[model samples]
Target: MEEAMDGGVRFSSLRFISDHVGFQGTIKTSPSDFIVVEIDEWGQLVNKALDEAVYETSKIEPEPCHSVKKPKLNIQNVSIEHESHGEASPAATRYADRDQDHEAGSENEGSVNGVTSECEKGSAGLLRSLLDEKTHTLLDRFASDVKGMWSSKTELTEPSLALSLGKVLDKKQRAALHSAVRQEFPFLITAGSNAEVVVKPSPEYKELCHLVSEEEALGFFKYLDARKENSKFTFKPDTNKDHRKAVHHFLNKKFGNLVETKSFPGRDHSAGNPNTAAITVRFREKARGKRSRLECERRKAVCTAFTLQKENLEMFEAISFLAVKLGVIPSDFSYAGLKDKKAITYQSMVVRKVTPGRLKNIEKEIMKKRMNVFNIRPVGDSLRLGQLKGNHFEIVIRNLKNQINDSASLRERILEAIENVKNKGFVNYYGPQRFGKGKKIQTDQIGLALLRNEMVKAIKLFLTPEDMDDPVNKAKKYFLQTEDAKGTLSLMPEFRVRERALLESLHRFGMTEEGCVQAWFSFPHSMRIFYTHAYSSRVWNEAASYRLEAYGTKVVKGDLICSDEDAGEHFPSSKVHLVTEEEESANTYTVHQVVLPVLGYNVQYPENKVGQWYHGVLSRDGLQASRFRVPALKLNVPGCYRHILKRPHNVSHRLVRPDPEVEVEGSHADDAMPSLSLSFDLDASCYATVCLREMMKGDI
Candidate 1:
């Protein structure tokens, strides 16, 4: 980090929390290797330091292999801005912020809407703008990385981009990434030093990408015939743009005469599985004691849950007005799945009213915005998470670590982990990491969510930054603060609802709650919001390192179950008080009631399904819950390796190199097709791959 002399751009201001933010400035890739670092925020260039970039040493780790040489698949995916339009929904105004809300925001701002325009109107809308700075950076990184390893003219059993991005890296790395990508400013890190600038995808650039489900996307392939036919490839990478890119051009040049590479774009950007993804959510009425949250759905002559087009309106923005636009929900509308920002998605949203005009206003608004009009029919059934009998995750693992000498051993280990996670089990973690490094946003979000829920008192007591709370503060020293415990806890009440909904929809499994949890969410049946603690003698300490922006859990009771003993070991214990009312010397630091998921061969049901597995589930008759509410709150889990020590003593040079693959890694849903994923999602966003990554990382 550059020492500041009054006017300067600080490194802390730019680095991302969990980024492989490679390269120093403007994401310029070298001709040989891709520069990697975490770019959560960028340091403003100070006039003085600009002329004096000194050098500092990094505490680099020793690994079996360092250099990587990716295969020359010569596969190139060029992304441009994706566009959508939605003008119909009058309620679809700008997002509500503090200023906007004070200026008289509408009741529908936070409510659930059926659909936004097929193309536009949401911060997380379909196909993030490639023009956006962070998203673009992410995409560019992939493009650059692919350039280094892939040569389009190669022959292989089967391959794809998503495979590379979703495979390769460890589960922890992927979890460091989340679902929606960062458009700009990744919370990146490198060799224990902050990079000079933010390395997130360029949010400023409009982003265009495939939003289709993997199954469907993989269906569209660069057929061997196409490889045979694509010899006359016209597309090529800009040599001056990225470093890894040469790999593509070079390999293609070498084997272009022998292999063929074709690009076939499918609907939703490319091919995606048509196997419908149906979710039944049970949400509570917004108002306190307003009965179960509204459960609104499409009445397509038959009773089905309400489905929404991703772009219809902003989900986060519309949280305040679900009732007026979609009709009153009985608080029974809880869902297991969360829709994505790409393409048109089909999933049931909840609502209470089931008449014809139930969603007339919403429907009318949808039409105006050009949003896809799907049904919001009611269901004879209630939807829930883990209700779909688990996802059939199928993805392509590409551009594996260049050092793998025995493909068989690597593949075996990869598959073994899946099975290991299943038997050894894993946690059912949330994939959103937007809360920033050390889960600062998650802390604030959880604190605020609790405050909004009238749990202000609890928020105050648990989230209070005792001595050292800010993840960025240099003086403060409560390392446990880095765990994002508050954020994890905050998401749970809603998780309860989500899981319940999963049970309602699938009826394939039943998850039992572990009874009442602790007031601070430090007990079982609760989610552990790890703070990336910096303290020692704690469970989450650095010795037990956790990836930034990742969620960890254990299963105490649920449809998804394994041995009870494994629960504690898999997830941290609850923070407890020696006595119920005693405010003693010892700190409360145990995290309990975690529900872990199993993966791979150890899976009990869906014998043929692949990926990380969920051990137990919400059984058919298990306390038939109507709604699930995830509420983030403050709690403590110490020693999480979230404390980032800025390189106060070092200067910059001989930058670190990026790992070859941060991509698709999973077993076949049924071995019906070769899986596919992208590498850019590497060290980036895990939610993008959702079920695919979860399969590999899920806590059973």
Candidate 2:
């Protein structure tokens, strides 16, 4: 079999198992035309409706967890210099003005400790009307005590102020008393149960008192003590860029010349741009000279698993959107696999430190965006890639080339193809998607460039201008001709994030060789590895084709077979056994049991002609087995094995006449075209397109 060329890269010599002429049609006529439901490791379909009962029962209210403490101060002392009164007393005029402001803003200020301003105002009014003159006098004395404690210069302990409300019979009266105390002393943290209320200084208030007492101590820098090793903190990677900018601005404003904040690209390449970066705040070298310590207790990790159903959204974009909504970084989220971007997909995802209640609350919002989340519950472990049993696909192949008017012929043709697939299976080649779309330079080409240590060529492949007349291509063309990163960026759209990121790095650092290498590193780690993986897939496809042509369904000597015990594991190469001459003569292994290695430094080639063919193929491409280990790039292709063939499970098909009344985009319904609908389940990493290609005998 000869390789076919469609995209920039060749198909690398793939062969078909079925001998049928095959039918022609188009898949994904609409987003709903292709449906995918993930089958989890437990063999349960990840459907939102199926988990409704569990979701409803598992719903929990968010706990009152003050994970992020507000830096805003509720208590401040301002010295007023009155010409008539010379210098106004610190305790009298300041307290009186503060009390007036609190009363005036009681109905309009934002929420305090989850209590609405309306509730706070109403409760305060009720308390005022219910309390007697003697009670008011006692409250005033308590307020004075609180004021005196805050005014003192000595190191402050937690201020304790308690007043008995004399066993109020009405529950509403006791609630009103609690609100009144909160309104009068906003800095106090209050706790109420039954008829009693205990008031103490808030964490913010205590910190404020400490700052006032120790005027010599630097503000935020004191927390970053140089004596304490590993004292730095990194903000979550999924933190919004705007929010991060605001934090940087705030730090510069408050602790001017005392601290520095630096942003580094996040390790999680699975997230889209902006969310793909993280910020680190640290004390400046000059500020680190002072010796001070501040300690923070770490919160325990919580992983909440949920089923996310999305329509026409890429996995990284969806994760980034969810991360922004949930106020977490993309790295905090884990999923079993990446689903299709052009179809409706349901898959399980787990996010750390997020509660089920919080995820549940976002369902309506996510639904508005063509996505929904449900089946939310706390799981002990996080989901990893390839953790699922497989994916179930319900695909509609529409606009049949010749069978539009002949339902009987369409049915017969589909059944014949299905039977062939069931008996012999399709060639297990990496789908065209692995090579990327259109006539643009394929990912494998970029991988080859990287392997050869050609940094500039790899970048040029990424930024090369296609023949399209779009603004993005024009921007690339402009950069190539003029090398004006800033000018090119202005013409590019904001949504073209990867291109913009590269241009920005080039603009900042200039177009030196080191700058280009740095620009390459600007991409997420996963993206950097994807290029090499595609190259490996290219080699594997060619090797698989050669093996089938030479050995034709025979499990010969040196063939690697993974044991049944290792079959259940995600990556079973660790337990693979090589067939001996005796085993080959005895026919101990079947063709279905054989596996092929995706060329890598650590992988063992078969001790046969097929293995020798791998070297020939690599040598032709100017690569060797050892080149997979690129230490300079921090990339190591340790390699893995994949099954040489796959037969889809529970295959079924039907032919349907299009409804005259229903309108489907890109569908020939008015012509009464018959559509071929297929339902099948494939194991993890197997491309469904390859199965379709075997039946249709057309380029996918």
Candidate 3:
């Protein structure tokens, strides 16, 4: 109804996605892709001329706070440069990061030619060796980092091998860069499927900044000088390759005794191979244990057994709230994870557990505040950081793109593609968002390192424990490496050797079965989580095999019969009246479904060559979808939440038995580590760390 300076008009229930006007019918895409595209389009529009197009933008206070400006990219003209080549190696990596090649000399320009960093014999020995080592490294890192990774390179320059794989970054590294950089960037996804969006950092920016440290701005400046100062370039590419993995590395002895990682997302799925998403939880407020000396001494007796239960609602909110309730300023209580505002989540807390029942009114107060508690457990030691494992998530997406659009429409095309992917499977290409418009995908480099280590570990120690000494397997593993490094010591030890080490650890950390150091130290914080995006992938493979098996075979809907009581067990059979059980079982098969909610998949009119767009694409062919990947994380029952179980095959578990047969020292002969926990409800893109952070928050 209203017109703008550029003369773009607006209407009810209508929006523009990248110069294209959409109003439910004109454009559409999958929920996740649509969300990303929309955000990108909106961001592009907003950044064009902030003064002319910014929404309700106010003038900034022209304060001269460090005149250094960060990198800036033109959103409209932004396009990721795709790298095209083969497997890369550590020597091939030129850019330096936390673990980057600090020893490497200045990189030569225009090195994309097929020359190897270490070509051997006829080939460039340096290039070949580098490629081999880096390739394995990149792959293993991809597998470890549960959050996934990304890589960014200046458009005009060559990207390192790590950038090509994506997901080689650490949390602190990313945070440090985010804190420093102020300019817009382009994200390139070389590997790994993930959800992300492009937007002008606004409300979230101005507000979140309040939480940033006073030196955060300055710190970023320092970091920028350390990385991009020398390069007069901008942007980079993903080897144009697809599929990258995240790597998890043990980082114990780093946080000390302050905190530890939790094993599972929550009480629901803390057993084994947890299907919880990895969520990162940064401490926003300080702990109660670190308060003033006077307060600590005065309340030492009363505060020792301070336990937080579901009944004690205020106990978990914040130190301020707890201090107010204790007839004194809320201070002194410590916590680990942050719990949800709404839900009756079980939590473990540490407090004085002392005299006169200091937390006497906990039940009454919690009830008054409309909170419920299943139970609260008190332990001898405080839960350190990183003690929690991860969170299981289950979520639903509403208003899915309808498939009714007929007449060879885009909607139909998308449906078909989705069906194929669900059933057969699509190339696990890094989604467009992985290489975001402008964020330095430095993490991908780290992923490469982790993956490399894992592969070596798998090879040296044997893919399975039994194969440790298989010289053939070890050689095979070694062959996979790009470097001449002999063998990996990480997994070099034999079964007995490693068993003895763990037993020793258990002994040092253990005083009693229950009051053991293992339990106290091996909390979620102490453990780094590993998330598996294995379901859709495995399902796709399964569908592929299924389709190949049933390609020409035909069966009707009801071909499979329930039972054939008339037929004897040895000769069980069904009548021909309906599709026979054998016939149905033979021909009728499960269709592969899409991983995300469906929206037609159709290319824009000209984008498709041969004018052969298959199904309708969301928004493009006239359908709207979520701007983010709002996957329906349907969790299986008995899982902490329903969303964690996205696909039927997705299973979460933790090391339960720890292979009891191989008994040794440190590992509690009694309490065993789980392989992985079960899956549970969680929103799409929500990190498991976030959930564990919530659960650990109640711990004093």
Candidate 4:
């Protein structure tokens, strides 16, 4: 098989779809140079502003009845009433008496309407005495509003209110006012500043006010518990002891014996520390039996689907950042698929138990991370991988003047290349990202070793370095030579997560075979499986090249063809059928319709010469089909089939001069160098880089 080396990794020499003189250009000059927007299953482009109107309209449900009116409390009217009458209300009289007691330096405490006079002792008592008749009337009206809203169960459109105190108060006075408010109205929470006192309903108060009901809470818990295998869902950790206590108290008061509450130290706590603990609420043993009638009417779990637009961040990295901000685990989020790290991309993400309001709240924080999310709306189900139809790409290739003869020639060549790609398509080879940029030992080499049950060899290959002079590599070398994991770790950078993990494991377990294996296993399961995936990709690449060489643009007998009924479906390998002699004679199938199986134990290879090539390739790597099913290693890969060719749609290109204001490296300010802008749409899992490789006819 023809082989070529790129970036120190050997790959199959892929054939080009277009036969034309190639031009040279540089891509990804900036994050904005490449833009990717995912095309969903319905062929709708996923955009940052897509369905914005729908999201806006769907945020709040309409009121049940238009006749239901909110009781209005006018503080200005109360001020007028106080001005007309000289006598104060009974509540105001009690507050004045407490203020006098505090000024008299009384040691004995008094209570007024469940509020301790001790809370009115210091600056708060002085502030109350300083309040004029109109201010006292305003406080009375605010209390009236709170009671009316709480009793009537009116929908809380503005859950919080900020009451502006006429004069500025010091920090201590503000703190005292906050404490007095809490003592005066336990259901309402308050935060005070110099100018105003902000009051809002607490979680318990909200529940009591019918924002959520006891039966609704129980129903939600039942729904969540039914879906969980272990019936365990932990709440977000809180460092505040009062927050933890409040959660336990609220659950106990509401659910009573129906649910149990437990408090455990947070995951990131220090030993024997109670301050860093969290509370978890679950169904009690008595409540875990047969479902009650109310439980039987459990509501389905709803998820929020949003369009996430990120710049220069890996898909997982962006998701993790968002998960932290949303106060949910990363596993709770789902996406159609991963996108390029360095390019600006828009993709849809779905997360359960996260409301659109919560996502909207974190928009500012997320924007600081070079990411933004919008068009958030409720969805019935979470998005699954490979659910997307494809992705639309807008790419700009710069520095074209160095390669092309003239502007006219460049335009002609680009037009011809675009037409060729639209008509014939390119070889569907896995991109270099699949194997990683391992110079000394590619990921597939480690996979081959793992398949042969060489754990230590695989570990060594993973840790070994190609550049000895690099700081991280030097640390690796030191660890290899002296087995000083701790010393090497000191020299290593914190950002090198994989390296640091292995070193830490070695330091703890010692550098024995078991320790090495433990260090290897310490990696995430996805990472461990990635090595084998790289191996499969390598084999598929070679097989694809061999298929093209043996039978160029021809569909032969025994070739696997996906049935027309399943052609539009993703992962259509299950509907694959081998072409018979009669079908081959009919000459209905083309090479574009052919499919190749990635190496796996359960997969069916093509019944042609290309299938025979798989045996030779695996054998050369000291592997066989049976080796793929390794139970002990959990490496049983039920490999899937991929199309042999990919035809991009809506292919268009234009040549434009570089912007005079924008500075492109190697491009002079005075020089009007032409840049190629390409727009195309490729099916899901097809690499745009591969398409570019075809047009460039060189290593991308």
Candidate 1 matches the true fold with a TM-score of: 0.25
Task: Output candidate 2 Cα RMSD.
Answer: 22.3
Alpha-carbon error at 490 in model 3, in Å? 67
In the range 30-61, model 3's lDDT, one tens digit per residue, is: 21211110011112211122233232342122
Number of the candidate with higher TM-score, 3 or 4: 4
In candidate 3, stretches whose alpha carbon ends up further than 4 angstroms from where it belongs are 1-132, 135-364, 372-594, 597-700
Computed on alpha carbons, the lDDT of every model, listed in order, comes to 0.25, 0.65, 0.25, 0.64
Q: Is candidate 1 or 2 superior in TM-score?
A: 2
The numbered model that scores best in TM-score is: 2
- Per-residue lDDT of candidate 2, residues 1-700 (tens digit): 6544522225634776568767778897777988999998657898835566654664433323242322211222121111112132322222222211121122211111222244344544655676787876666676566657766744454312344434343444554555465555555544432233444444444443443222211222223211122234445464467766765665455443445677778777555564666666554654433211110111235678888989998776787678778998766788877788789999999998887889998888888878988777876546655678889999988877643344456666777778888877888888877777555688888898888878878888888888999999999999889889999999998767678878898898878777778887666545676788888888787777788888988989988876441242223233467899999999888887778888776576787888888777788778887788665565767576787878889988888887779777865442377778889998877888888988887776
Candidate 2 local accuracy as lDDT?
Answer: 0.65
Put down candidate 4 lDDT per residue, 1-700, tens digits, no spaces: 3444422225535666567666777888878888999998667898945666654654433222222123211011011001111133322222221211111122211111112234323434544664567865676577678668756866563323434434333433554454445444545444332124555444445563343333333333322212222244345566788766766766666554445678778865876555886566554555434222222222235588899999998776777678768888666788877788889999998987788899999999999989999878877556665668789999988776434454457767777777777787888888876666437677787887777778777777777876769888888888777779899999998656667877898889877777776776656444566688778887887778788888877788989877442233223233577888898888988878888888776567888898788877777677877787544455556566788888888888878876668776865433466888899998888889888888776767
Q: After superposition, how far is residue 54 of candidate 3 from its true place, in Å?
A: 47
Model 2 clashes, total count:
1
Give, for candidate 3, the lowest lDDT window spanning 10 residues. 635-644
lDDT of 1 by residue, 676-700 (tens): 2312211111132322233333211
| Candidate 4 wrongly placed segments (more than 4 Å) | 1-9, 50-304, 319-333, 351-362, 376-382, 401-408, 466-470, 482-484, 501-524, 563-574, 630-635, 658-671
Error of 3 at 447 (Å): 36
